[model samples]
Target: MSILLIDSYDSFTYNLRHLVENATGAHVLTIHNDSYDLPREKESLNKLVGSVDAIVIGPGPGNPDSAQDVGIIPYLFETFPKTPILGICLGFQCLCLAHGCTLGYLEHPVHGQISRITPIDRNSLFRDFDTDFDSVRYHSIYISTVTDDIIPLAYSEDQCLMAAKHAQNLHFGVQYHPESVCSEMGSKLVSNFWALVEKRETVPIRDSHLLQTEPLIKHFKTTLEYDYKYEKIPKVDILSACERFPDPLLLNSALSPGEWSIIGLPEPGRSLVVGNSREAGLTVGTWKGETKAHSDSLWSYICNHMSQRYYEPTIGDPELAKCPFVGGFIGFLSYEESIPLTVNKITSGPTPSTRLCFVERFIVSNDKHTFVVSIRPRDKEWIQQTKSQLQTCSEPRFLSSVKAKVEKPDKKSYEKSFYDCQKYLHAGDSYELCLTRQTKVHVPKTVAPWELYKCMVKNNPSPYSCYLDFGDARLLSTSPERFLSWNNQLSQMRPIKGTVKKHPQLTYARACELLKIPKEIGENLMIVDLIRHDLYQMLKEVEVTKLMSVEEYQTVYQLVSVIEGRLQDSIYTGIDLLRHSLPPGSMTGAPKKRSVEILCHLEDRIPRGLYSGVCGYWSVNNHADWSVIIRSLFNYEDDLCSTGTTRCFRCGAGGAITVLSTCEGEWDELNLKLDSVLGIFS
Candidate 1:
């Protein structure tokens, strides 16, 4: 069963979706009340009303008396008598008029203020409630005379009826908007409505809409009874302390045959899956089973360390191109029986060490997988040097070894298939089209693995950066600006886009000075402008909460800014925002779609996969936190290897420009970025 919310305005829909879904787990569809230009006919109203189990008249602007003349109200009362109906605010006034009640206009309507609600009688809708409670009131029209058949369920202390139920039909109305945060008993009202719709067997109705006399007291008692103690268990160590590991880049090539299956690991009992079409992309387990914090918080924790460790140092000495350390981390929650896994930090282990850190786990579904990752020093220096050394010791692996199979359609048939897919998109069947194209790039030996690694290390501003030395296969690496993530009402976005190269004459301090140039600021602003525009489409008036500023990173100083926007009324799912604003503008140049097209034409591949894709979790409440997957490697089972062993390694790199970027400079920068992952090879 589903509930259709009609004419609902912004963010209000978000709260309503949450309320209804949580109470009954029913599908909720929201339709903009004004967006539809339906002919005011009884048949039109019936058709709209017939599509759902219940029609909730959502809160919106305009006088309630005006809506009655428009024909929706009269049609509802005259035609659909059996269908359950609900009205909030203006919706309530319309309901009263439709039920033969008179709407009396107030000289001055009190808006957005608290009022005392007094219960009139015992009913299932307000089954369990106290005699009185406070709720938000925002209406100018009052139901002066209710019909004989309608029973008054609740009224304000001033004698204005706040809630009424039809004795003859499954119809209800509330003058007070129950969807607002100010509605003290709003959630209970929704729950009661669900019970009625779901036809749950009930014993008897009680007076009052508020259930518990003191819900806060019960909550405190419940909190105190909860236990946090756990028994210490034996930890499992990796088989060998210093096994000669294969190239991290080769890991994906080795494990490609598995096609990224999700599996529950034994020791930690966490689900693990690796294999995204892109070398660094992710289709891993869901993040819902992990921590409760927002995604931006996690990104801030990681990026803050990256800025201090890698960018700051690189800015001081540009020649120091190699920082042989890099790692990835994931935070999540699993089953109660699953134990948290801890790996050695390698603070003083091998010459070049890296670690990925997993914070804490949260929730896991019966069929879903959950796991967290951690990589240490979380600085750019270690990441760059590690990759440089790793590359010097290894050979470039071919693409065929790791590339997933692509089935091409015949030329004549491909167009038809493409159009069908396009039709699906236009009809809102899918948000994105995932397709593949073959491409290649020349790998010059001048920028050897270590040389390139050093260049990137010297140039990078974050302590934690990534490098992908795909060799002739065409390199794709990324240094990301971890964007916004949210769980429920909380949401955030971090934007970073500014760069300065290390020249022989430029000292680390000089490089930081260079980053403050106006041209660089313009570039950063362009991306910010684009991001704000994209956000505005699905969000409310977005504010540049954090102005553009230069923050010191490991190797250099970076120009960073924070942009914030409130989610729209209809946008309830985190995935919805992701689908609309993906391949972050900071990473992709301004005019995102055009930038992508230009990259596709100039670069070697389409569908960069997880390399530029996001990884994170979406919780039960539709809140999510995801990160752009950079400075990471993929592992997979290799059937072609003589030893039949699985391969594992990481990939990293940066974006490009056709006009301003020279071939040699671009090539050098690419090498610099790859040094982090390559350093691990040596």
Candidate 2:
């Protein structure tokens, strides 16, 4: 069987596609609603539609009244009246409107909220189901009245029209999202739809007519090339080397000659990976809004380099196996590198939008042991020289204090943006918008980047903390959120959404209660759905392993959720997964593309730079890990404050803005996040 899913640029469209395939054993082809809306593509779209067994109009943003929103969806109903059709959310609204029904605004718009779905009658879509079931909803409009030719199948707890079908046509519509993780009996519901599709009487297409779908088939098919090889190098105890030259001293000396990337966490869960471009390493960078060639080469290099692994095989130390990185590409991507820009152009910054170094020599440490390793055929002599320096090294005296200045965000400007986000929410432009503001910090040039990072780590240690210096740019990130991480076995993403500041009156239980509120949970749910959409693109059997759990960080309590999926190595590489799921969903709001567009305008075309991007390493051991660059400080060469001796940095901070977000509440949350990083200066 075959199904054509007409996606309306919604994040949950893939979830629906996967569900339909699982329930009906059909090959599903998904295309954007506008993919074939052009006059030139109409005939091809018709041939494509006729080739499929059924058609599904998926949910999306915007009202059905706008032709721009619904695109060719309305055309499908008129042209193919006999085709079996199932419409969801925005699609449902479009379906109802075509049959002479009207859509009205919901008094309380629900996005990422679960509601009880009560069946008006046991139709084919809800057959053998409970009287009432729960399903997630993301809509601002609902069908106000039913047409005479339409049969109402279900209603929500609040008595809104939830599901309906045409009396004589093979068309069905549902107002809620059955593809959501929180929805109940979703598979059974999809199975019931399959039954309806089979029972409908329609003229079958000839086998010769089916050949017209070749173009569509080719569009969905993905081809991957791989060539795996391994080579062995040398290894040494990192702590033994660090014993004479501790991190403060060792990193300080290393930073002067070349670019450096460090990913470290505190002891107990302690692990640190440091690599530099001192020898046999290439320092490559792509500027903001640069052509795709530069960034593409970086991603291509990671894939090729990781596939051709170089390692020391004789050192079959079990401790080495536990370490995630042995030496590979270490770098950071600026926020602009991840998403399609809605604005015309991004003003070029002093540093590149993305920077990476192919590290041939590096040091890695875990709780029990530490080691310095290298990739073979190069960096051998450099390792010997580094070891000699470590042996004779005297602990460098680090400066205790550095004069600094902070430029706080203007409150009136922030509150105005908050209101602007609300206007978009009410207008159905977005369900949740992650609004952010940047704060400026200035420190004397005498303060070393390593020392600044060391102090930041002492103040706030995170699971994905790092100190990155790429010649022109430096980043000190103490982010608790893990954006994406995957090894040979499985891939995972932990997105942090809700936040509760730690206080004398707050308890763990109290924070739990606050995080579980409908508003907070809704914010997290939107991002969760967005991430599921991202994973489904390159993975199979995606699962939300943990949902809305309170995780305690150093200074605040955060609501974090874990999503995991396995990557089929033959079909998709870790780089493919990383590249496709850019600019973490937690940082960008739901319905990613639209939300990013809105953010660009609301933030006044100022590029977020590296502040909300991701920083991590793609390892030689076929492992990749990245963190959403939040609660972090970053500096570009030309962006320094108004003095020759002072070097300035930017810290981006914000909260997710939903319909329920208060102006004052969001302002306070933004400041609370800033303090976690900016406090080190104090």
Report lDDT per candidate.
0.42, 0.72
Worst 10 residues of 2 by lDDT: 211-220
Across 566-610, the per-residue lDDT of candidate 1 in tens digits comes to 654434333345545666655555334434543443333323333
lDDT of 2 by residue, 1-682 (tens): 7888888888777888878889988777777788764677788878778777788889887889999888889998878888899999988888899999987887778888999999977868989886699999888888888789788999989998889888888889899999998988789888888887754333444432221111101111212221212222233332234434323212211111112323221111122222212111233323221222223344455454455553423346765655666555667887877565743332233336766555545555444444445554454665565556544534434346555898989999888899999877876778899999888888888787767776776677666777776546778877888788887568899999999999889999999999999999999998888889888876667999999999887789999899998864426656666887888888879788888888988888777888778888776555777878998888876663536888788899998999888999999999999999888785
Q: How far is candidate 1 from the true structure (C-alpha RMSD, Å)?
A: 19.6
Among these predictions, the greatest lDDT belongs to 2
In lDDT terms, how accurate is model 2? Answer: 0.72
Point out where model 2 deviates above 4 Å. Answer: 199-298, 305-314, 342-351, 377-401, 640-643
Cα-based TM-score, every candidate = 0.35, 0.86
lDDT of 1: 0.42
